[model samples]
Structures are given as C-alpha cells and as structure tokens.
Target: MDSLILNILTPVAIFLFIALFTLFAVYAERKIAGFVQDRLGPMETGKYGLLQTFADILKLLQKEFISPSASDKILFALAPILIFVAVFVGYSVIPWGPNLIPSNTHTGLFFIMAVVSIDAIGILMAGWGSNNKYSLLGSIRAIAQMISYELPVGLSLIAAVMITQTLNLNEIAFNQGLLSSKEIYFLGFWKVNEIGGIFGWNIFQAPHLMVSYAIFFIASLAECNRAPFDIPEAESELIGGFHTEYGGIRFAFLFLAEYAMMFLVAMLGVVIFLGAWNSPLPNIGPAKLADWTTGPVWGVFWTLIKSLFIVAVQIWIRWTLPRFRADQLMTLCWKILIPLAFVCMAISGLWRILIMI
Candidate 1:
C-alpha cells in the first residue's frame, strides 16, 4: 500500500502481464490467422498451438543478429529500447481495476499522448538507422502515418476530457460507471467533479463522439502501426519494416516495444473512451470486487477479461484486414480520419452546449 512499493511492483506486474499476454497474443494471432485463411494453425506446439508463441520466442532468440554495414549504429541500437521504455512507461498511467490503479495522476491523458507521440520518433530512428532504403521508406511511412493520425486522436481525447472535465484516469473510470451514487473524483484530491459521467462511457456520448472514438481507434491502429495501417513495416515488401536489419534479441526488443505499445493503446482506449477500470453496470462500479462480497481476485480477473476483449478485437482486425498501401494510408488519414475527427469535435461541442442550455 505504500506508494513507493506500488511504484516498484506495479511495473513489474504490468510487464509480467505483458510478457504473458505477448506469448498468448502470438498464439492467438496464429490461431486467428488460420481461421481467417482456412487452415489449421499452431496445432503441434501445445494444445491447438497454445505454446506456439513461446516456441517463436525461442526461435527468434536463437536467430543471428546482423547490423547493416552502413547503418546508424548508436541510434539504431537505442531506438527499440527507447520505444519499449516509452510504451512501458505509458502503462503505468493506465487505470487497470477499481481501487486498483498504478499511478493515478491527473496528467494521465497527457502522459499517454506524450509517450505515444515519442514512439513515432523511435519508429523513424529504427527505420533510418537500419541504413536500408526500404526500411527508411517504411519508417518514413510510419512517421507520417502516425503523426497524421495523432492529431485526430488528440482531438478525440480532448473531447473525452472536455466532457468528463477531469484528467485523472481513475476519475474518468469512476464517472463512466452506470450507477446512482455517481462516485467520481476530479483530481488526486476531488476537484470540480461533474455529473452524469460520460454519456455511456465515451463511445456513446454523442453520435459524433461515437464517430470520434471510431476515428480514435482507427488512428490508434495507424499509430500503433498495426494492419490496415501497417505500411511502415509491410513485411512482404520491406522484409520487416524498420526492423529489417535487426535480429536475435534486438528484434525481440523491437517487438517487445510493439506489443507493449499495443497493450498501452488498448488500455488507453479502455480508460479514455470506455471508462478505464469501471464495470459496465453502475451498481458494481462503486463497490470494487475487492470489497467484502466478491474478493480482490475476482476484481483483478474481470479487469483482465475486459482489457483482453479489446486486445482480441485488435488481433481479429489484424488477421482479417490486409495491410494498406502507403498512398492510400496517407489519404485515409490526411483526407478522411482527420476531417472526420474535427467534425466530431465540433458536433460534440454543439451537443454539450445544447444539453447545458
């Protein structure tokens, strides 16, 4: 219960969760990929290839490390580690479960965006450091795509904060619960707490906010550099995107950053738009599962279940959707998602004013 102990243990727990999740995610991807492509996946490794990810890790670990002759040595080496650190740091700000957050700072949303924005720099550094034209191109694509999408993503996040009137992620989660008592905090100490929470978390707030949440998720996909927005690391063409030259443990770290970022964004989405650690029903919101009735274990259990459902959807999209072409990617972001996000912001403003008046 000491803040210092919490500061230390929480990260260990988060990364451990991420480590286990990554192995499972890899297997899940294989299984989902099989189902999508009409074939069996990971049937031999563990039951239905459940242990497939661990096996992949072993293989990846054993692979040789090869740096390109002309690569930017220092930056290339530092880039992935920097990325992993940035993303992992963001996880500390995520509100995991009720009465069960890491560092519930008022600057949570700010911290989330700040760290995520930095990841673009890492992607670019890795791409350029590889000293390969295709990798450079991939990283460039990643930079452009991620930067473009972040604007709308920021706008949508602004919408949530503006409506909720607090930046503390735990407070936001508390507000979203569909309960009568309305237990919401505005700061580390209660600040001007508003009412009604967010209109059905954040997704259902306004039709436009719903649109913004969609835009945010799509932008997040691009930002995370996942499928449909995966041009930066188009495997068939670029051989591995920014990480083409990386191998062995270095490559592992790159993806460790990738998976960590994936979890960070998913959890951020859950917290920002979906009400971080709050339960769906209001009655359960105030009473944490750690309360006398359910026990702390169930509280932790349900939290992971919710978070994983979001992550699973991300995986589902990856296997189902083909990667986007670079030109199409830019067009979707600059032309489509950005403008759409702006409209959502404007509408959200209008709706809020209308409700007040």
Candidate 2:
C-alpha cells in the first residue's frame, strides 16, 4: 500500500511542481531581461509583478484556440502533448535525494538521455504538420541542431561513466558525498578524502573530465535550444519558429516544455558533473555545517540551487550574445565539440587505467 501510494503520488507531485516552476521561470526571465535592458518589468500585475505570470496563465487558458487551416490536424494537436510529456517523463529517472527517485533503475542515465531526445520528434511533427514553410525550416533546423549536439552530450557523459562505471544516477550522487568510497588524489602527492565532496566531483576528477564538463555544458545549452545557439527559433527569421501556428494552451505547452527542458538539462549537468545533490564541501571548517544541512531534504534544496544558478547563466548568455549563424552552429558542434569530446574521453579513460595499474 505504501509503495503504491508513493508510485502514484510522485508523478503528480512532479507535474504540479513543473507547472508552478514554469510560471516563476517565465517571470524571472522577463525580470532578468528588464534588468539587463535598464527597465522595470511587470510592476502592475502584482508586487514586482509576482502575479503577472499567473495572470498570463489564466489569460492563456481563457484564450480562443486557433489552428492553422492548412495544418495536419492530428499531428498538429499531438505535437504539443508529445513535447510536454517527453520533458515531464524525463524527470522520472532523476533521483532528488535518498529515496526521492521515482524509479531506481541501473540504466537511469541512458533512460533520461533517450527520453529527453524524444522531444525532437515532437518538434519535427510540429513543424511539418503546421504546413508553413517557416515552420518547416525551423523544424529542420531543430532536428539538425539536436542531432549535431547530441553526439557531444553523450560523449561527454561517457567520460564520467568511464570513471564511475555505472549509469545509475543515485549511485552517481552517492559517490560524490562524504560517505562514498571514491577518493581524490593530488598528482600522487596528497589524498583528498570523500569529505572533500566538491573535489571528488567528476568535473574536478581529471584534466580531461574537466574538458568533458565544459563540452557537456555547451552541448546541453544547444540541446535545450537556448540562447545564442537557439537558431531553430531565431525570431528574426522564423517568427516563433515551429510553434508559430500554435496559440492558446497549445502554445503554452510548447513554452512550458522549453523551460522544463532547460531545468532538466541543468539538473543533469549538476548530477553528472557538479556533484548532484551533495554539498560542495565535506565536514570541514565552515563546510562542516553541511554535515547537518546536507541530508536527503537538504539534497533537494542544494540541487535546486545549483540548477537555478545554471538557468540564470543561460538567461544571461541569451541576453548577452547574438544568435549563431546556421553554418557556425554546425561547425561548432562537428568540428569543435565532437572532436574535443572524443579527446577528453580518451584522456580520462587512459587516466583511469593508469591509476588502476
């Protein structure tokens, strides 16, 4: 009975959380944009426009549904649902903290990477189904960008898996905390205990994995179709891109899915590279407070803090840089990121083998 209750409630809780988080994220993006541009944002809807996002949600719900007359009605309708569901379901394999994961599978990492990639298909459907030339162009751009960058994303992760030798995200998180057996050494000079939690994280594991993390972060930005790399939705060219034909709640789903994907990739970076839910330090000095403050509950809190920081960086980059040209986008992925990822993986693998010998 307890297990069944947990199984039933987890997805419900995550769904509600994603919905609410998307509202705040939208508000945050607007405020951040205003700050960047030297203006105040949305002051009238509520204090600092706190209610603005909620108001927007209500307005969307009440808005009349409009569909492109030329669109394939079935695929047009199904697109938003698939995109939203793909992002939402990817959360199932992520372990929030001890016993907080919805599903504890050995192949959690592979499962997440696979599930998140499904959004590409939905995106293609949205573009092709809409029957707009611009929409088709945007969808083609999306497929190309996703496929190009996904190679680096997976390869970067391979470096970490080589070190940890497991795909279970919970184990990945556990190995970063002070209680785990993984140890860090300083060029064979000094040994850092697991209590040196941040030092034990994969990003700091070796020179190669550090490069891997850098590649992973960049690829993830492209994966989520955010910022300078967001060529698929280049407003100057494609209007609203693949989602141009959608309105009302259909548009809302697509919008929410984008933000949710941002959050999801940010969390994945934290888990695979930045130490997941573990505190940045072991029980030492001021960091000793983490010993008490860094349990399962605190794990969730830390994870959110890290993930939100990444999101903030994404927003900052979005406002700071110009969008990449299509050729530049492809060149960066294939010529630069993919090769760098391969070198990083090879170096990390060699380091692991050397240490064992």
Candidate 3:
C-alpha cells in the first residue's frame, strides 16, 4: 500500500515540476532573447515580467481549440497529448538523486531513448491529420532530422556506456561520486576515488569522452528541435511546422513538451558526462568540501545546477546561430557527427583496455 501510493505520487510530482519548469524556462528564454537583441523583454507584466508566462498560460487556457475544417479530428486532437506524454514519460528513469528516481530501472538509459522516439510518431500524426502540405513537410523534416541525429546520439552515449559498463543511471551517477565501489584512476595513474571533483567525471576520467560529449550535445540540439537545427518549425518557412494547425491548449502542450525535451536532454548529458549529482569540489588536505556538500539534497541541487547551465548554453546557441538549411543539418549529422561519434566509441574501448592493462 505504501509503495503503491508512492508510485502514484511520483508522476504527480514530476508533472508539477515540469509545469513549473516550463513557466520559468519560457520567461527566461524571452529575457535571454531580449538581452541578445538589446531590448527589454517583459517589463510590463508584474515585477521584471515575472508573471508574463503565467499570464500567457491563462490566455492560452481561455483561448478556443481550433481545428482545420477537413482535418482528421481524432488524430489531430490526440497528437499533442501523445507527443507530450512521450517526452514526459522519459523522466521516469532519470536519477534526480540517489533516492529520488521515480523508477530506477536497470536499463534506464535505453528506456528513455526508446520512449522519446515515440514523439516522432506523434509529430507525423499532427502533420498528416491536419491535411496540410506545410504541416506534412515539417513533419517529414522533423522525422528525417530526428532519425538522422539519433545515430550520433546513440553512438556517443555508447562511448560513455563502454566506460561505465552499466546502463543503470544511478550506478553511473554513483561511479562519478566519492563513494563509488569501483576504483578510478586519473589518466590511469593517479587514483582519484579519494579526490572526487571534476577529476571523477567521465570526461576527465576518459578524456576521449570530451569528443563524445560534443557529438552528444550537437545531436541533442537536433533531437530537441532547437534553433539552428529547428528546421521542422522554421517560422519563416513552415509557419510553425508540424503543429501549424494546433491552437489553444493543444498547442500549449506541444510547446510544453519542447521545453521539457530541452530539460530532459540537458539532464541526461549532465548525468552521463558532468558528474551527475556529485559536487564538483574535491576533498584536499584539511578541507573536505566534497564530503560536506555530498548528500541526497545536495545531489538534487548539483544535478539541477549542472542541467540548467546546459539549458542556458542551449538557449544562447539558439539565439546566436542562424537556422541550418535542411541539407546542411543532415550533412552535419550524417557525415561529421556520425564519424566523430564512432571515433569516440573506439577511443572509449581503447581507454578501457589500457586502464585494465
């Protein structure tokens, strides 16, 4: 009975967190855009425009749900919910802290990748059900882009997995912390298990993973349909892409899913490469910064801080880089990222063999 109740509340907590995060993320994006473009973003709506996203949410809630006259009503209505659910479900296996994961599946990483791919089907349904040419084109671009990028994303993550030898995300997180059961040496020489800081991170432990992380980051941007790689929703060309026909609450759900995807990918990157929930400070001499800052609560804190920093970088890149032409986007994914990802995977294997020797 207690376990059942906990399971029920876990999803509720995740939903609330996603909702609040979407609100803050939208506001932050607008302000970030304003800063980039040299203009005040939302000064009029409450103090420092803090309430702007809330106001926008209320407006969206009150707006009418409109569908195209000749559209397949069932699929059109179901698309947003399906898309949002696909992204939302990916959070279940995410290890927020040592004890905070909603579901600590052994194949947590595999589960996230599989579930998140379902959104492509939802995107296709949105485009096809609308019976609009632009919508169909946008969905095609999204499918192509996502499928193409998944290669690099998978390969890059495989590099990390090769090093960790576990698909359990919590175990991966543990391996990066001071209390790791396995011994880790810096550059296969200096034992760093006792000194857990940036040194213990996968990127530092296996320097080749820095390349893997880069490939993962670039591919993640495409996965999230973020700017530069946001060909699916190119405002100038597709006029909102696969979601062109959606409005009101349906559109809101799609929007929310996009932001949630952004956060999800960022958090995944943090867990795999940026030390997960472990503190970046190391114990040295008389100072015990890492030991003091390490706990369930601190785990959550460090995880969020690292994840948000990655999100901020995503936002900055969105505003800084111009949108990629469809051809250029595909070329980068197939030719450049895929090759680099393979190299990283090879390096990960070699690194592991050398360490064992």
- lDDT of each candidate versus the true structure: 0.74, 0.86, 0.92
The digit string of per-residue lDDT tens for model 1 on 66-178 reads 77779989988888888888788887767666657777798888888898788888888888788888889888878888788889889888876766777888777666653
RMSD of 3: 0.9
lDDT of 2 by residue, 251-302 (tens): 9999999999999999998988887887775557755754776688888998
* lDDT score of residue 277 within candidate 3: 92
Model 1 lDDT at residue 297: 59
lDDT of 2 at 174: 76
The C-alpha RMSD in Å for every predicted model, in order, reads: 4.8, 1.6, 0.9
Worst 10 residues of 3 by lDDT: 183-192
Comparing candidate 1 with candidate 2, which one achieves the higher TM-score? 2
Q: What are the clashing pairs of model 3? A: none
How does each model score on TM-score? 0.87, 0.96, 0.98
Total backbone clashes of candidate 2, pairs 3 or more residues apart or in separate chains: 0
lDDT of 3 at 101: 87
